[model samples]
Target chain A: MSPEKVQGGLEPSETVAIVGASLAGGACITRLRELGFTGRIQAIDCDPFAPYDRPPLSKRFLAQNTEIETPRWWSPDCEVIRARAVAFDAQRRALRLRDTSGAERNISADAVVIATGAQPRRLPIEPDGVFALRTAGDALALRHAVDAGAKHVAVIGAGVLGTEIASSLRQQDLQVSMVDAASLPLVRLLGRGMGARAIDWMKEWNVDLHLGVRIESIRCDHGVCAVTLGSGVAIESDLIISAVGARPAVDWLINSGLAIRDGVLCDASGSALSMGHNVVPRVYVAGDVASVECPNGSFARDESWTGAKQQGVKVAETMYYGAQQTVQPEPPYFWTEQFGRRVQILGRVSENGAVSCVKSVPDRNGGLFKVAESGAHVAWIAINAPSLFAQVKAGLLP
Target chain B: MKVALDAKRCQGHARCAAFAPETFVFDDEGFSRVREGFENVKPELQEKVRRACTNCPEGAITISG
Candidate 1:
């Protein structure tokens, strides 16, 4: 395994600055050390607290106040900088950081990794006191709101995060109402069959359904919040949470000389691409901020938790070992815990593929497999059946 | 070397089982556990187990000497 470094790759003594102490950034730092890279890692964390796991923020963290401390691996051989990366100088491999006190400074490194992840998208008519879950502080604020006698909650957007937030709030005995423009929740990702099933689950959970409707306006007046729909009907709640979706946190890299469509475009190895010029010197993008070029010659930004973690590892391997490893990209996978059931999706589901229920139990514990005409399993969605999902994901299902 | 899977922490991301299928077993709900006999770790399987431990999002796997 002793191989020369790729052209322009970082040396063991070089320092790497990771902007955004996100899952991808965290994973990259850990994997680099595991790969025997002795480079100094600067972890730039924007959060007030140290880097902590975010998945629980919408799950157990809000529902039960479980404390998720920073992982033990982040402390050793790494400098934790509590600052936000304001700008990136790709040409000079430098970053402009703005600390909590509004102080700004420029620090340079041999290699730069952008793992800023994404921020929750707000509604056009978002009023004051609207809640959006992205960080630990945001989760705490929501929990505080609930603790402060928040009974009825209106959640906008029925996407994964929104749905999970709704489920979590419901677990607290809060009356939750969900509003989305799509006719069905997760219709784009799960398609009609599985999406319909999702609707059924939400309905069964007693979440006030406001699907297939446009939110005209949101107003919080006199201690009551009203979400007005396009049909002139309004659903009143004590609080409103805007979870329409999220946009990649690539605003800082706008002038970084890297190509940006939806996100910072990168090659399969996570190397940031610069149009009409040689690739930006050792500047890589991973996690939600990276729009990675896939084997099929298409660019995709995988915003899921698993995708971010895998990309973190892959980018670290490329940065340290010089991209020689021809590892196959792991299939895209994400799971949502809603209504106390774990719904997981693995692999790509072709738009026109046939989706059939391979095995289903009355308790909503089963697998839904998607396949093209070639008879190969293209995608699988398992509800409350993790073991079976793992088997089918490992190609055990013939 | 020995490894332990914290049942409380495992939210069933299943990256452990994916990385080291022989060493990690999945429960019905998709959470992972270090296989019974393999918790002690074999010499050849140590690397895979390490990878699994690192890849786990939940950080449920613990490796100790």
Candidate 2:
């Protein structure tokens, strides 16, 4: 909380620069304006398009044949610059940016928000007709491929995104086979019982689940990909979608002296943490690019849309209030739509936790609750039962 | 202040309940709702209610007098 540790507070006339211009950056800028901050704001992004939500990329946006509209949140007075930040000068609080034309520029600001987000993790052998969805363009390209008669799809990784894509494709009458190295998809997040339930749902949706197998090689010929599993079984498909998760887009922060681990390491208050445990002044991080360490000593990189937006507001507050204002940390929240059902999860559920069905009916399939070994309610998962989820969430609150 | 919730957009994050437990309550399925008789947040808890609305990631909560 020292001013020298995390830099001085913001002044009314000082300029604040934000990188990424994705959900987190958009939230930060919009919240700042909502709070009536008159300081100069510079929002930067490499993409030509304005800020947009990414959740629909795999669901509605990909399934529909309509135009994708970018969500507008910035004020008329705010400056939106289309450029990629190449480097950061911590001492001077300036960033070196490269425009689309390859022209370079330097912008100095009193505070900087790194919301660069993340990019999809690719496999070692990327053959033709392989796709990964992270941005709007990626989704559009995959949709176009599907529309172009790509019949059978082999989705690698059965996590949230992969399962979601598989489910969506099934709804569109496209044959989908989902492969995952884990014994059960989402086991790490939902634990054994709940994760097994997800498997049952996927089977019910007719998605071929190839679990506990490693992909040996991917060979593509004439717009068709033949994926050979470790068991010497080959699965052929018209296209392959790799939803193997994402890593923080932190290439620009390298060599800038910031402690780069899985993502930009930050304290709970959203200030960037250096290698020696000191806060890097004026540098705040949010969204997928930020791995925040809580007081409990564990670090979490919440890649959900909700986490990104919440962190964005917190980081903006830290920039304006100089870390003096204690941020009330919210529970981790995430939701996914697939198999014509909405799966909503709130709070953290450990792998060994005991899960029980809090509510069960023909309409509501997944109202399961997990409690820690200490009998503390840890997490709740609901399928199309948002109100039930909310009830469980409220009871867990202090 | 009058507190409103865009129930459809709420993903049952429960952040609103955490910030203002007295003003907000959870529906049977876990989405947020104004307490049984607290549709208009009490004057003493209005600030906390506002914080709850502000922290909602879905932007589902709103407050206006």
Local distance difference test scores for all models = 0.82, 0.80
Best by TM-score: 1
> Stretches of candidate 1 above 4 Å error?
A72-75, A350-353, A364-368, A371-376, B27-31
Tens digit of per-residue lDDT, candidate 1, span A80-192: 89999999878898899999899999999988888999888787788788889998899988888899999999999888888889999889999999999988887656766
Q: Which stretches of candidate 2 lie over 4 Å from their true place?
A: A1-7, A65-67, A70-77, A396-398, B1-65
- Candidate 2 residue lDDT tens string, A223-269: 86888999999999999999998999999988777788999999987
Worst ten in a row by lDDT for model 2 chain A: A1-10
DockQ of each: 0.55, 0.40
User: Which candidate number would show the highest lDDT if scored against the true structure?
Assistant: 1
True contacts kept of 1: 0.51
Report the Cα interface RMSD of each model, rounded to 1 decimal: 2.5, 3.8
Chain A alone, TM-score for each of the models? 0.94, 0.93
